[model samples]
Target: MKIKRVSEFVSIKRTVENGTDEQLLAVKAIIGNVKKDGDSAIRIYTQQFDGASLESFTVTVDEMAEAYGDIDKEMVLIMQEAAENIRSYHQKQLRSSWMTTEENGTILGQKITPLDSVGVYVPGGTAAYPSSVLMNVIPAKVAGVERIVMVTPPNQNGKIPAAVLVAAHLAGVKEIYKIGGAQAIAALAYGTETIRPVDKITGPGNIFVALAKREVYGDVDIDMIAGPSEIAILADDTARANEVAADLLSQAEHDERASSVLVTTSESLAQKVAAEVAKQLAELPRKDIAVKAIADFGAIYLARDMNEAVKAVNELAPEHLEVITENPMELLGKIKHAGAIFIGRFSSEPVGDYFAGTNHVLPTNGTARFSSPLSVEDFQKKSSIIMYSEAALKENGAKIATFAREEGLEAHARAVEERLK
Candidate 1:
């Protein structure tokens, strides 16, 4: 890998913004079919894409119990601990309703209510992360969502991974279906025969899944249209090249499309890191993928100084940003756009990805500039409550009517005018 100017490293467009008409048309057809045919459509798509024909989509209690037994009991215990951490972190984000009474006796407040049901999509076909199951389900559970249904593509054997099933069980998700892709999204957004519709859907998938979420957004609320995983490391002279290389590979191994970038003020450190990345890439099991990702999207930058480095961090707005320096926390206030910031050498990216209490589901691409990570709020809605008193309305009626009249909204003015006279 070569070091480039930080300005040149940014992806030109939103990753989600670009999609071939053919792909979109194909996804649209899948969504339409699932909406029309329901469970039958899901079964057919599973057979065609996953190479598995399923008579039933729902994962039965027997299957879940078998899954728990199949996975290592030690791993299950660790997942339980991770679930507890995720739950504890998200419980703090739970909101409550409150009301206030003014001197005029007008009541105003905002009411918080959790969504009735939510669907979570876990990708299949060589993509599986038990950590994702914990991250996605626990937040919804903490938000008091009544139902958390999970959908995942089945392998050719027509089975979801045992780790995934075990993680879901520990996270308190009882409803899981063996379906995936655009059809599963349609089933979630618009109900099917066996699978009930959900108020919202959250989780990651391939491009088709992201597009499906984009298409079905209005029908059902979605968390975000996430893209490939990305990590940006802003390191100074004190940063270790080997440690930096390891962290970059952590995200790069995620997929060939994933992006890993380093912005450093030390030119020597940049060269050493690029070399260390090459050295370490040889040892990784996902070396082929990490190599392609590093070759295609990964970058190392030679920033003139820390100030210039901060500009690059804010520009890319990566899903994960690690600041490794003498005083990493000192740069926290200056950085503005990363989804999650990892400070110091010990606080590597994977720490947050799996074990850290922070939600791993983060805004990808440049969406971190505007969007946020998955949280309890994603599973809840707020309603504004306004109770107008007679005295308050009488005091402000003409003013409200005059304001409406100024905008040429005659009916709106009349609606308020009726109370004035």
Candidate 2:
């Protein structure tokens, strides 16, 4: 890891994945075939990509029961508690439909309505992420979505992971499908013979899945085009170098493209953390991936002062930010841009990822500056409410007509005038 002055540091720029021309053509073909052929197209693609031959895509009650038997009782209990925490946290974000009425018999407000259906894609290849299942589904459930569908690739044995299925059951997902990749996204957006089309899609997947999401965005609403995981730590002399190094590696092990950085005022701590990262990197099971990530994207910036350090952190706007100063809370207001902020050494980044109530799905690659973590609001849509009484329209009709005609909207002007008459 390079140690440089904050003034000389530059945050790396990352755009949403634009697949190669060949991949784009491939995705388009897959989407077209799924739209045209429906369930048969999905079956062919599932066997070709996932190496699983399945007669039916739907998950049955027997499979759900077997999934519970596959995992231990303790693990189920843990996920149950985690689900409760997630549900409780997101419930706080729920908003009710509201209206305000005036004495003139005019009413104006907004209506909040949850989407009718949603599809959540859980990646299933090298690793199984039950956590993602919980993270994606609980919020939609909290938002009162009536139908929630979950899709994942089947293993060579033609089965979804037991843990993933257990998580889905715990999160209140009723519809589960054994399909993945771009075809799964297409099925979610356009619908197949068996699977119903959803109003929105959320969750993460491989490059093909991402490209498919980009391809189908306008047709059905999407959460965001996510980038690799990222973490930035702002620590002073009071912070422990080993603890900081461990936290950085937690994100680095996720992928070779993942980034872990440290910005600190103490030169001694900066050097020590670099050494600690090297020491810890050697012991990790995913050392190959973590080493490449640290070599390419990891760094330690030596700020002239705490103010300079905070400014640098704001410019980076990483997905995860950790403050390890003596008084971490005191610096919270000074920090402006981060998907999720972990205060004090005790509040590690992984706490929010697993056990804590906060959503693990967050903006990445400097997107935290403009976007936010996924929440209940992502599953709900808003409609403006307008009820104009005869007297109210009589008073405002002329002004409304004049404003519409100013924009050359003669039809709009006449529509308002018709009400007045």
Candidate 3:
């Protein structure tokens, strides 16, 4: 980690990936083929990319049972508990259909409707993310979405990870497909013969998957295109150097592009944390990845005061923000623009990533300035409700007609005027 004065520090710059011309063309062709050939196209791509030739893509009851048997009983219970926590938290976000009635018999309101269906694309290469399963699927389930389909690539032996399957089952997802990459995204967006089209898609994936989602966006809604993970800690001298280093590394190990930053008022604490980060990096299982991430994106800034530190953090707008000051709550009102805020030394970043009720699917890069974390609202749609009685229309129709006429929409004007007559 490099140490610098707050005035000299520059925020990490991570550009959003726009796939190469070759990759974009490939994704376009994949989507086109899936649209034309349907299930057969998916089968061909599955064999080529995943190296598994599966006659069937759907996970069967027998396979689900086998997955349950394969995972440890204790781990299964932990997943169940995590699912419950996620469900409870998102249940609070549900909005009821509401209407406001006027004395002139006018009724206006908003109707909240869950999407007809949703496709969750879980990444399948190298690592298994049962945590991703819980974070993505549980919100849709809580939002009352009836059809939730999950897709992940299969291993060379044509097998999905047991933990992934177990997490999906716990999250109430019945439809699981053993296919992945750009082709799986195409199938989800356009629908193959075996798979039905979904109203929206949510989940994180590699660059190809992100490109596919971008290409198919208008046809079907998609969650935001996510970037690499990030964490920014606002700590004071009272904060433990070891604990702060560990929290920063939690996100650094995620990827070489991931960012880990610390902004503090205490110069001594800043030096200690930088040294501690180096010591701990040597012990991390993903040391090579973390080392590059820390080298490329990590930093420690010494601020003149708490106010200066807070301002720097606000400018950074990290995906995850931890407040390790003497009084974390006192600064809450001043701090703004983070995807998720972890208060105090005890609330480490991973708590929200796994056990805590909050969703870990957060805005990355500097998107936290304007965007939000994945939530139940992403799985639901809002419909404005307007019911105008004869009396109300007679009173207001001429005004509406005039507005429409001013816009040069004669048909719209006439349509409203006809009702008035």
Candidate 4:
């Protein structure tokens, strides 16, 4: 990791947006074929990519029960606790339909409705993410989504990970499918003979899945076009080097493109953190991936003072931001952008990733500059509610017609004008 002065650090936004043309073409072709051929296309792609010959894509209730029983009893208990925490946290985010009545009997408000069906795309092959299953599924359940379908690549033996299936069941998700990549997104976006189309898709995956989500945006709503994971720490002299190093490595191990940064007022602390990162990197099981990530994207920014450090933190707009300073919450108001903010040294990034009761599926790259974490709101749709009494319309119709006429919309003007008569 490089220890650079904050003034000398260059922005890496362009590097984060680097998606290849070939990947786009391949993803587009996969989505197109899946849209055209349905389950048959899914089977062909599953065999070609996942090395599994799947005659059926659905995971039946019997299979779900068997997977739940197959997992260790202790692990099941832990997942149940995690699911409860997730449900409790997201339950706070559930919205209600609201309307306001005026003196003139005019009524206007927003109607909050959960989607009829939603699909959660879980990534497979490299890792097992039961945590993701809990994070994505619990929020929708809290929002009262009627049907929740989960899709993931089948293992070589045409089986889903037992822990994943168990987590889904714990979170109250009954529909599970063994299709992945662009095909899964297509199956969820466009209905197939075996799979039903969904109103929205949420969850994270590889570049191919991200591209597939990008391609299927209008046909089906998606969470966001997520990039590589990133974390930026803003600290002063009060922060510990060992804790900081561990937190940075936590996100770095996620991908070679993942970024880890430290912006601090103390140059001595900067040097200490760099040394600590190297020391901890040597001890990580995913050392190879973390090493490349740290080499390519990790850095310590030595700010002249705390104000400058805060400036850099906001500029990066990292997915995860940790404030390990004398008074962490004091600076919370100053932070304008971050998908999730962790305060104090004891608040580690991994806590939010798994059991801390916050969404781990966050806006990556600099998308944190404008977006937010996945929540119950992501599974919700809002419709405007408007009602006007005859007297209220008579009072405002001419004004509305004149405004429409100003925009050269004759029909809109006439629609409002008709009410006047």
Candidate 5:
């Protein structure tokens, strides 16, 4: 990893901006073809990309039952525990439709309603993230989404991972489809003969999947165009360099594009953490990927003081932030942006990713400045409720009519005028 003085590295940009027009055009072609040709387009793309010839895309009911039997008992228990924690966390976010009446006989409020159906796409290739299933589906279930559909790639043997199946079952997914990549996104957005279109699609996948989601966003809602996993550590001399190095490597191992950065006030601590990262990297199974990530996107910066380090972190706005200092809480008031903040040495990124009872699907690539982690709100829609009594209309209708007329909308003015009469 490269080490630089904080003053010099403070203005670093994380990832490149969004994709170019050519990339968007390719995604658009895929979406349009899927919308036009339906299942035939899906089959062609699936065979071309996933190396699997599917006689059918949707998983059979019996297959789901078989998955449960195939999975290990111990793994099943772990998934159950994770599901319960995820459910408990999201249950607090559940909202109900409500209304309030005034003495003037006007009722004004908002109604919360879950979407009819949602689609979740899980990446399948080198790994299967059962945790992702819990993160995506539990929030939808909590929001009362009627039907939750899942899409994942099948292995060359045409079998989904047992853990993936078990996680889907625990999260209350209604259907699972053996499909992946842009084609799977197309199938979800447009719906094939076997697959029904969903109101929204959630979860993460590759660049093709991200581009597909970006392409199909207007047709169906998506959680966000997640870029890559990232973690930033803000530490002081008080922090243990070994622990900080390990935490950074945890995110670095995610992918070659993932970023792991460290900003500290003490130059000595920076040097120690750099040595620790090199030592830990040798032992990591995914060391090559982590090394590339650290080489390209990761860094250790020597800030002049804690405030400078905090400023650099806020500018980076990493998906995960770890503050390990003598007084971690003291910096919390200074932090204006971050997807999730991990305070103290023990509160590492993985804790929040797994069992911390907080959603791990976070904003990436500086999006934490405005976007939020996936939650129950992503699955539910809100509608404004407005009811005015005759007297109330008489009181406010003129203002409404005047405002509408000022905007040169005659129909709007007439509607209010007739109501008043």
Candidate 6:
């Protein structure tokens, strides 16, 4: 990791803003072909990219039973525990449909309804992320989603990961498919002969998956166009250098494009943390990925003071923000943008990623500036409810009519006028 002065670091833009239109176009073409050609396109893409010859894309119930038998009992227990924690957290975010009526017979409220069906895309290319299975499915289940379907790429042997199957079973997902990438996304967005269409899609994948979601946004609801994982640490002189370095490396090991940055006012601390990172990288199993990530996107900035450090963090709008200052609580109010905020030395990123009972599927690529972490709210839709009595309409109808007429919408005014009469 290289140390840069705060002035220079502040002037540089975060990497999230540099998306290419070429990638978007390529993704759009893939999505279009899949939507138009259906399973044929899916099969061709699956064979071309995944090197699998699949007779069907859907995973059968018999295969799920086989997966359960193949998986270890201890792993099942762990998945149960993680699923319990995820369910408990999302249960708090469950909302009820409500109605309020006044004495004047005017009723107004909102109806919260769970989506009919939702699709979860779990990546099977690199490794199985059973954690993501729990995070995505539990929220929709808690929101009362009727049908929760999961799609993941099958291995060369044409089998889903046992861990994924166990997690899905724990999360109450009855439907699982052996398909992935842009084809799976297209199948979810537009129904194929075998795969049922879904109302929404959620989960993270590579650039191809992100681009496919961007293309299918109009067809169905999507969580967010997630980019690479990133973590920004704001530490003061009181913070430990080794601990900060370890936390930074935790996110760096995720991918080669992942970013880990540290902003602090202490010059000695910066040097110490950089040295500690070098030492730690050697011991990590994913050292090559971490080293490349650190070399390209990671940085340790020496700020003049804590205020400057916080300012740079806010501008960065990182997916994960760690404040390891002596008084992390005091600076909490100053943070304006972050997908998830971890305060103090004990609150590490993996805590939220695993057992902390918060969703780890957070906004990335500085999208925390406008987006939010995945929650039960993503699985539910709100419909406004308005019921005005004759007297109530008489009282407010003229105002509504006037507003409509001012906007040159006579039909809207007449509708209100007719209702009042």
All candidates' TM-scores?
Answer: 0.96, 0.98, 0.98, 0.97, 0.95, 0.94
Q: Tell me the lDDT of model 4 at 77.
A: 94
lDDT of 4 by residue, 176-272 (tens): 9998888899899998999889999999888788888888999889998778889999999999999999999998998898999999998888889
Question: Candidate 6: where are CA atoms >4 Å away?
Answer: 11-26
Lowest-scoring 10 consecutive residues by lDDT in candidate 4?
Answer: 10-19
Model 1: weakest 10-residue lDDT segment is 9-18
* Candidate 2 clash pair list: none
- On TM-score, the leading prediction is 2
lDDT of 5 by residue, 1-421 (tens): 7789877875435555356788777778888888888888877777877777888878878888899899889989878988899899999988889999999999999999999999999999657889999999999999999999999988876778888988998888869988888888998988988888999999999877898888788889999988778999999999998999999999999988888999999888899999999999999999899999999888998888888899999999989999999999999999988999999988988888987778999998888999999999999999999988999989989999999999999999999899777
| Model 1 whole-model lDDT (C-alpha atoms) | 0.89
- Give candidate 6's whole-model lDDT: 0.89
The model with the greatest lDDT is 2
Q: How many residue pairs of model 2 clash at the backbone? A: 0
TM-score, candidate 4, is: 0.97
Candidate closer to the true structure by lDDT (higher is better), 2 or 5 = 2
1-421: candidate 2 lDDT, tens digit per residue: 7898998989965555788999999999999999999999999998899998899989999999999999999999999999999999999999999999998999999999999999999999657899999999999999999999999999988899999999999999989999999999999999999998999999999999999999999999999988889999999999999999999999999988899999999999999999999999999999999999999889999999999999999999999999999999999999999999999989999999988989999999888999999999999999999999888999999999999999999999999999777
Error of 1 at 122 (Å): 0.4
Off by over 4 Å in 2: none
Q: Which ten residues in a row have the lowest lDDT in candidate 5?
A: 10-19
Question: Which tens-of-lDDT digit does each residue in 206-281 have in candidate 3?
Answer: 9999999999999999999999999999999999999999999999999999999999999899999999999999
Candidate 6 total steric clashes: 0
What clash pairs does model 5 have?
none
lDDT of 2: 0.94
